[model samples]
Target: MTVPIEDVRAAAELVALGLRTGARPTDANPYGRLLERYRSQTLFRDTVDTVASGLGLVVLGAPARTGLVLSTQPGSVFAVRMGDLRSTGMSADEKLIAGLVVLGVAAYAFPQEADLDSSEVKTVEVAALDKFVRDSIERVLAVPGDPESVDGQARTAAELYRRTAAFRPKDRQPGPAKGCTQFAVAEVLGWLVERGAARQMPQLGASTFQLTDRFRLLVADVAGGEALEAMKAVRAGQH
Candidate 1:
């Protein structure tokens, strides 16, 4: 099977484009076209896969597929790519929401004693997340605080979090254009959308998102083990 130099270059560029942007190109894009060709051509698949592996990436879309999921390199080593984080402009509260979103999705994606081959990802409503954060804040606020303060100094991160737990999620952070909880949820989902890891249901607007297979595959292990187990326990009322 003869291979053209142009095809090789095109395929490499397709991969490079995905890594740089953290998103896949549309099917009609030239990079996407060449990517499909390289994947389908038996002779070229190995070549492309080899290049992908060398670059600490994995080609996750099928040869016949239109959408590609150029995922990060597997394993904990690539668990949280610094480059991906830098691209996201998430504040502290939003970061917490992002972590919760993963746990929320993982609860359904990796069920216990299920026979399904692929993970069954669950959609999370923004309100549900907001309520969750709000509930936590409430619980923390209810707890009696230690009167001792270090030289009557400023509150630490944990202290601030505890204090804010009593406030409404929207009231927690003020001065932002959007309510803190709402903005955080939107930004977190937006980050996932940019990574091709999740997509918002147009009808659901900012309310809900369907976690993509890319998310199940990439985020599973990172969100797996005790974290997922805890979520499952909570769902079953065992926690």
Candidate 2:
């Protein structure tokens, strides 16, 4: 079968758009036309998949309304490491806490299976999320057993969080500060916004955020993981 040169060019363009800004079929002009081509033409879709695979990317799916979703394969250039989320001058413990904060956001945003399935927008606030994570840590610690039995990362994050202040000092300069739960949560949320996983809801509040469908897709891929399960257990026990 002779593959049309136009199909290859279109496929490359579509994948490029997905990488650059998350190509949506709902988008105007070329993006919409290319994505529509992807859905309608098997050859074009195959070519797009081929291009993505060559670059170590996986096309998660392309829902008409949501557009093209992509994920990086292990070692892919686009893969975001935990260290990438770390702020400058952060200690190893602080980095762990950052990871915990991300998990907390995911848990708080979609605590139940039904929530994940629904299209309803999920929102989170920094202070509320910090409180929830701290409470979750305490709940886990309260379990009767050797403290060592608890997940090591969770324990470490909890200890660090406990030692940290919940808010920055009133007299301190304005900006994110290390060892402050509010700042930590805010930083993580901001990072999420930058990565297209979430968006700030300025009308709701400066620190409030709404998770995007992209984040939902990412979380769904890891919905069965232990970390999420533990967080979900904490949420379930509360209600």
Candidate 3:
């Protein structure tokens, strides 16, 4: 069967739009049209999926409103590693804390299963998120358990986080700090904004952010993990 070149071009264009950081379907002209085709035309949808797969990308979702959401495979050139989330000269503990910060943000933004399924946009404040993560870690650490098991590892991480300060002095530099959870959370949130997972809402506050559909898709994909489960449980207990 001869495939139409126009369909291929359209599929490629849609994939390119998906790859652009922070690009939503409603953001511009071609995105809305391409995404509409993806939803209405079977051939075009398959072609778009094929194009994404050929490039080692996963088409996570293409909801009518959110458009095409893509994630890179483990070894794909577009894959983002934990190292990519770190700044220059970060220690191992700080890196681990950064990873936990991400999980905290996800859990805090979507505390319930229904929240993840809903179309309602959720917002988070950096300072509040930092406090929540630290409190959750402390709660987990307080539980009596073996010191040589998975919970023990979690406790160790909690201890490390507990040692970190909630915030630094006002005169400190404007970046992540090894001893400040607030700065670390801010840095991680900034990275998420750049990756299209979240967007800053300055009107709400200087450090407030609203989660994006792209982030929802990503978190829903990994929502079953143990860490997220624990965090969700902690978040649930809070309110």
List of clashing residue pairs for candidate 3: none
lDDT of 2 by residue, 1-239 (tens): 87788878888888887775434456577878888888898888999999999989988876666567789988999998667875455677777788778878878877888877888888999888988888787744443434444355666777788888888744557544656888889988888876777888999987789988878877776635455567777877777
TM-score (C-alpha) between model 3 and the true structure: 0.86
RMSD over all Cα atoms, model 2? 3.4
1 against 3, candidate with superior TM-score: 3
| Full-model lDDT, candidate 3 | 0.81
lDDT tens digits, residues 81-166, model 1?
32354364545544444454454445544445351245455576665654544433332233333434321111222234333332
TM-score of 2: 0.84
Counting clashing residue pairs in each candidate, in order, gives 1, 0, 0
lDDT of 3 by residue, 2-63 (tens): 56999899899999988887567763588998998888888888899999999989899887
- The lDDT, on a scale of 0 to 1, for candidate 1 is 0.52
C-alpha lDDT score of every prediction, in listed order: 0.52, 0.77, 0.81
- Candidate 2: residue pairs that collide: none
Pairs in clash, predicted candidate 1: 137-165
TM of each candidate vs. truth: 0.60, 0.84, 0.86
Top-scoring candidate (TM-score): 3
